[model samples]
Target: MKSPENLLKSFFAERIKGLVQSDIRRMSRECERLGGINLGQGICDQPVPDSVKEAAKSAIDRDRSIYSKFEGIDPLRERIAAKMADYNGIRCDPDREVVVTVGSTGGFVAACLAFVEPGDEVILFSPFYGYHRNILSLCEATLRFVTLHPPNWSFDPADLERSFTEKTAAVIINTPSNPCGKVFSRQELILIASLCQKHGALAITDEIYEYILYGEHRHVSIGSLPGMEERTITLSGFSKTYNMTGWRLGYAVGAAPLMEKIGLLNDLLYICAPTPLQHAVMAAFDLPPSYYDQLCADYARKLEMTCAACDEAGIRPLLPQGAYYLLADISGLGLSDDKEAANFLLGRAGVASVPGTSFYADPEDGRQQVRLCFAKQDGDLEEACRRLRGIRTARP
Candidate 1:
């Protein structure tokens, strides 16, 4: 008795039935339709470093286009190992502990598949990245959310302690987090480390925005914390830092036993990441320290500009200690909810933003907020800012 559409839906797995394009992608499509400036998605449209471009060209010329070792090329893994030791303070073996992935998202998928199962419970901080939540859902793991209160996005230690129980299998941490931008401090990490050790649960961290910090915040890897070296899977990539998102290069570092299963999953899923791009990203590591210093300084300026624009539009910008996102309170705009606020910005200001409800488990938590990405190129960001500042004039 089913209709054709119902029959087609019945053919698909129940796990995927609820899935749809995220608000980030949805707003991006709407922005394209309206010829609006997109501040919704975290697409860093900045130019990739010239050295990295030349390296890719050189690799192509030398015909380094074959499938790489499933764990990635040796040289790239070595560079990642060295970077982890120096930057993240995590000592890892390139041969045994590191697996270059399609992207950090790929690594996350592999990790979820390798460890998570139907009965397992994964603890995620609320106001989480949508991919993280959805991926865990696909793995059929029960998710326990601990709320990250805004303005500062700090969570109470007692709440975190309660989230862990005998059923806990893993906890995902995204420092310099997306949407709100909370960098977990060493003291907080130590507490989390203690919980993981006590509950005998694994820790999976996403550190893609480790470099794009502002003010006095410092990046700390949970894997480097005491008693966590063997229990933590650390994920990061070249996309955000080196501005090569299209290249689809990233990596995972953890103890050999855990990485062995993740490596097998990576091979089964992706075969391998792009070969020539792996050779090229080595050039990114050679860039000077000044390059990183400049990266932070540039983002700090962009943050200031975007925050000022929001203030002018009567939106209260919640300042981030790190990352290139700003979550602004739109209560003063007289909008019903985040979706309305987002549409108002897009339709009137010619600037698109993601509804804040997209980031939380409970929609009401982000009812009056919208998240904006300031990671655009200077011209696009400035134009977006100008559009946002003119929003008052465009009000109905």
Candidate 2:
């Protein structure tokens, strides 16, 4: 008889072959292996708010560890609904239009599964968050990419319009985007919303970085646009805002009919978000606006520190407007590509960062850039900066 590994080759689905762990996670592991400062993944080293933690402890002590409703626990869902109305300029009925998910990542996957069919076309911006592409591919959807150019990372409205067709099912918008940190402007989102409307496409947005804005860069949900509320699925979570990534709590809001399907799919997949974590994040929303103000103030200082370090090393990073990421131009490093530069930095400089190719559809688009996260603790970030300053001299 054939061995189990050999027998599985014929049985594995084609989709399984294209799947791999996220490069960010891979780089984080490499950072660990080398005992280097990790700037590869956008994980917050900041502590979760004390109030939220206290709430979690209270819930656990009260034995609230049982399964929640398929949508979510009512208290958390109600708070999320109120938040949507107050902050996002949109209204949702918590019991009908919202469903808690494992994370925004899970929300995206559930939205894709709820709407896409095999051979359907999904529009994605180039330099997109990689997980979005992975979910779409699993749905067997044909991908149509619209390139976002460098520096500003903006595209012509006509170019966006041309990418959509009658067969288009969805378009993913990641604002305050990962890797690049380019927050989509309101005008740009309006343009995209118009195209999605014209094509009868679903606008599946990832607003996970909604709160981490800097210096006048605002986050506007495409779903908030006129006439778009019916066609958009908004996904966000407490992971970034509350520094509760491990809590894995997220939620999705959409039209009642579509959200009903997503709720059912959530039942089939994750069943519900964590009960204790849900209770914890209910307190997260109650945090004073001063808490978020301080968050931005803190990250801004970190961003400047990292940018200064890159300057000392003769690298130019695209300064971010809303997130804690820095995508630096590594073309001056005398290396062949971003991958080699990233490895060189890891091995020689003792700092880890993600290669830009991980974010683009065509590798060439990202060949000149590398992404680093500045969300580390201040001392770790300071150390990362110090190490990075020596990359040029250390690369013998």
In candidate 1, where is summed lDDT lowest over 10 consecutive residues? 387-396
**Least well predicted 10-residue stretch by lDDT in candidate 2:** 387-396
lDDT of 1 at 152: 80
Q: How does each model score on lDDT?
A: 0.94, 0.89
Task: State the lDDT of candidate 2 residue by residue for 1-396, as single tens digits.
Answer: 989898988698988788888778988899899899999988888999999999999999999898999899998889999999988998999889999999988788899999999999999988888888888999999999988887877887888888899999999898888867878999999888888878889999999998888888988999899989999999999899988888899999999999999999998999888887887789998899999889999999999999999987877888877788988998778789988988988998889999999999998988988999999988999999999987768755
List residue ranges in candidate 1 displaced over 4 A: none
Model 1 C-alpha lDDT per residue in residues 101-134, reported as the tens digit of each score: 9999999999999999887999999889999999
Candidate 1's TM-score = 0.99
lDDT of 2 at 275: 87
Instruction: Report the number of the highest-lDDT candidate.
Output: 1
